[model samples]
Target: MTGDERTTTVGQLPTPDRDRARLPATLTRVVWLLWALSLVVLGLRWWRGEGWELAGVVAVDGLTVVLWAAVTFFGGIVHSYARRYMAGSETIDRFFGRVFAFTLVVLVLVAAESLVLFWLAWLAMGLLMADLIGHVEGWPQARAAGALARRHFLASSALLGVALATLWWETGATTVSGVAATVDGASPLVVLVAAGALVVAAMVQSALLPFHTWLLSSMTAPTPASALMHAGFVNAGGILLVRFAPVVTVEPAVMLAVVLVGAASALGGKLLKTVQTDIKGTLGCSTVGQMGFMLMQAGLGFFAAAITHLILHGFYKAYQFLSSGSRVEHTAPNGTSDGGTTGPVGGAVVVLTAIAGGALFAALTGKGTALDTGLLLAGLVVLTVMHAAREVVRQSDVPAAVRYGAVPLVALPAIAVYATVYGAIEGLLVGLPAVDEHAALTPVHALVGVAFLLTYLAVDTGVYRRSRRLYVALLNAGQPARETLLTDTEDYNEY
Candidate 1:
């Protein structure tokens, strides 16, 4: 069979011959049209140099337009892909409806001028997602996943409501922009409490640590839903932080808490990803790790970098999920490998090259305050170390010298793209409220950096690989429901 035929046949359930596949195609076209219209509207608004503002209750700026554009762009792509991938499914129309609705809700949330609208949109999105997750009503796993997601989302919404209420009570600002503008004048105690609540809300929404099971369980949903959820909704937490950057950046305690939680989630998610046996599970774990990284960027006061990362990762993950069915066709038919390994010396060379490339890019950007600079430098070191390790694993057969040379060639271009995107976002958000003061890096930041480096080294060096028990535990840490979800029972019993 041809590659396309093979992909279409794999893991696909048999559908009735009379299935109305054209419904999904039509839905896809509608979604694309809506996306195009949004672009036109946003562009005209930008051209006129006027944003919609409703008595400090609602506002839209360049940043809002940019974020809305991204959501629509990705949402359209996913809709188009799903039109084919889910063509024969019985509930294709329902799937398309939910996806389109969720996309619209996200657009509203991103452009919401007031805190009340943003919170309502946030809650609505979560409920819509849960409905989508339970689209296959007869499937027990889908029901369980939906239930888990609803519970977490409810808690997240409550926390976010409290945070918003506090901001309003203290600043008498009903709009996000208004709240941000008045944050500096609020009492320190009020700011800290509100920021803490917001961070916790973000953590829950992003599925950090204890709240991550929903993401994994959610793989039981249709592929299109999974793609959209991970690619878009999962990053809402980062968006939340960026939206409230003025407050989050000023509260050092809140920032420290964010960094700590983000670091833990990143490490745990990465470790879990290594042990996943299924593609969806692996992708789910990866989303958690990426969310953690995004939150860490926000914690370090790299608001622009966090936004850039969110946008890029959304596109990358959407592609990953939509094309996941082609994995079988792309794999080596014989399943054999050269089994080459990069020794310590080669690994060191790759790491050094990556670090140098990252440092050079950081210097070129020349943005951020001194504290931001230090935090960026520290983050770059960790990023490069991880990047080099990945490169080493992928190209284990290459000579050390050639690999070392290639590392810069690859790393530098990626860094450049990141910096360019970050700069653009910074420019767009320049008029928005942001913390401008630079504070010296505290010992906690230093310790977090050290811990990340050491953990990476240990994982790369096979410390966990050497311990079978540890490896197994890490692999199954948050996967207790995996067996229940994957089992092939025909009964409609709820899990």
Candidate 2:
């Protein structure tokens, strides 16, 4: 039942006291009503001969409303269904409530992105949404949960809204050049203003250093909230950076500055991840690292590469957070599990489909950008394989279906497809006469990749050499891995 442990009995989280949990219910209804109204407006606009393209976009925007409804309604329903099973457990109720709150925030975001122009407003509104939901669900533990939610809501919303608005207003004034920026012939003042806005945004999102403290502190919230932060909110830093790329991309110096900052965050996350003892802290550091990669790709003018990495890594990390408790159990009980029903064959099918889709897209685009795409994809494959290998070694008792076959089976093919495509693209790009930026991928690039790979390999080997008990201890140590500090909330007893 504790926050630190990884196992739970059947029907652990469920809904109860619905009549008393009126605030979340009221908020849910309000959101649904807004969604319904938005749909009707979009429908009427389409009927009035707004361009079909615009209408289509409206429908896509409706997706956010639907996502919100699904998460909230279904979570509530699930709680109701399990009420009897969870008869007396406020812990489980609060847990599900936190999840519902996180889902509410995500829905607001995706919905806002669909509308494009309303993003600042969405960011603003989403701040209070989680706290309101937490207040409702955490009725039993109302004081502590509500206090945390309020602080989180106020701080995040204020920072996000102000930073984004500042960027939009200042950057809105100028024209730039290059792949990322649209404004051209920007003045020094403009550049300085834009840079200031970005630094503020970076600070707000906890890009690195000081901003990172918020993320670590958020671990005190519910498990699902922790998962949401690691998987989505934390990842927003890289996404926001890319979103602002238009302003930052003009100056090579600025681009390098952004990349250097991203590189630092990545290295910090990696080093800290090595020492993390708590599961949430481990995941949090990993997220910081992933965001760093996204920012790096954006700085490289490989926008699509960054998006690809973000989508794939975000889903997997989220799944990991949601499934952490399941992992401790070591076996599927009943039919309920956090992982998808996808068995080994299903996993293979998913991987193959992804590869095939990538090939198809490359063929269609045929615009020579595929080479960058292929390299990014190849790097993803390398990272994925290494991660699976690490897990296989750490959790040696995973299901035979996954442990022996699925991991290697899915990973090896992905690696092969990515490597082959990357190598072919590189050879073509390099061997072709009169290609621009040919010197970009010189021996230096190769040396850097090799050096990074070797460093990671050494770290992996060291972990493998240690006994499981020692490995577990190292994993538990978290950020200050070398120094074993004791915290009452952390579960040192289990390890």
Candidate 3:
């Protein structure tokens, strides 16, 4: 069947054979249902303070159960969404099968106690996602995207393999739990090298900074595939780090380096997002920034917070990708936004609300403005609340009093909900050690913070718009590979 002969005329995605769709849809739905039921069972066990292990093969505890619940829940949501979204696609079953396989692999990854099993599951996930990335097999752009992603994923796998192999060699531990127990006995040099490999592997998988092109170029994936990849797959990095927190935190310098790398990626991702012209590209950049921030939290000795960050991020990104189509209709004419002005009264309200939000966060989460990473976390909470307050005040049409009142009403509740979730996640992740570490504030942190703030201010104030060289550089960096570009419809039609 040719592209022009298909029934789906709604978007750029290919159409399916209607008759064949039901089989895959039904099979996927069945699996999703079973997966969801398993989550319930796991939750019950967790509530009862029970855990399980399979004699050094697999384990189900706080970390495993939480990740299982998260991945399967997202998988179920994607499967349900795709049943309708992919109804008329020819390879609907194939897509569903691959997605089903990927979800299972992730479940295994989270549960695997054996290092070899965990590594294999991790490797298989990338291969499955690469296949999904090129689900539109006839499209050369899609094929190129899949190939690029495959290469990056392969490299990520190789790094992870090397890290795990080194740990096994040094610690003589065949299982991840065993490695953690004996990792300290390994030489410092060996541990440092292995930890570095793990960080690189995670960065590649999460599409952080220099490794981000693969994800950005993967726009050719079906929307459902994109949603699953962004929601669940990219989150593996944070999970990897969290699971191996013992190795990562062996040296304070290594953790500091993670913070530096994460901060750089976070800043870079946000900057690059501003120059993206496409919706998927922009969202890809946003994922990079979010993943970077998650890693930063991990580096700060907040593994539980990192897990919470990824779980919430998965929910948010999945919705964004699935509903990206609606964004077109709602887009303002000529790309204009509601950017009126703010008055002095509204400005004062912003400052007050931000402070209150910060206080509320500290009180609720037990992370106050101390001489540690808690200060950084508190500052982020303040900025988030301030941004929320700013948006409310930006509504020029609303009365000053209403806008002022609405700021706290919106921001406080959000802060409260987030703090509550953070606490719950911390409790659920108690089985894993090193979930929360407070790094003492250093001069380097202060310097980096100042630089990040200045860069943010410059970008927000449109200072970069005047710099042609910087803008062009960023634009080029933000673009997908040349082979992945679909300049004309004929490119796909040629197949």
Best by TM-score: 3
For residues 96-156, could you state the per-residue lDDT of candidate 1 as single tens digits?
8888889889988988887888999999999999888777865666777788888889999
Write candidate 2's Cα lDDT for 131-161 as tens digits: 4324334233333334443454456555545
The true-versus-predicted C-alpha distance at residue 95 of model 2, in Å, is 9.4
Using lDDT as the measure, which candidate wins? 3
Q: Estimate every model's Cα lDDT from 0 to 1.
A: 0.77, 0.47, 0.85
Taking all chains together, each candidate's TM-score versus the true structure is 0.87, 0.57, 0.93
**Candidate 2, superposed: residue stretches over 4 Å from native:** 1-15, 21-182, 199-210, 328-377, 390-408, 412-451, 463-495
- The candidate with the higher TM-score, 1 or 3, is 3
lDDT of 2: 0.47
Local lDDT at 451 for model 2 = 46
Cα deviation of 346 in candidate 1 (Å)?
3.3
| Stretches > 4 Å off in candidate 3 | 1-19, 330-337, 397-399, 489-495
Please list all clashing residue pairs in model 1, or write none if there are none: 58-113, 59-113
Q: Model 1, 254: alpha-carbon shift in Å?
A: 0.8
Candidate 1: misplaced stretches above 4 Å?
1-23, 37-50, 328-339, 367-378, 385-405, 435-439, 480-484, 489-495
Backbone collision count in every prediction? 2, 14, 6
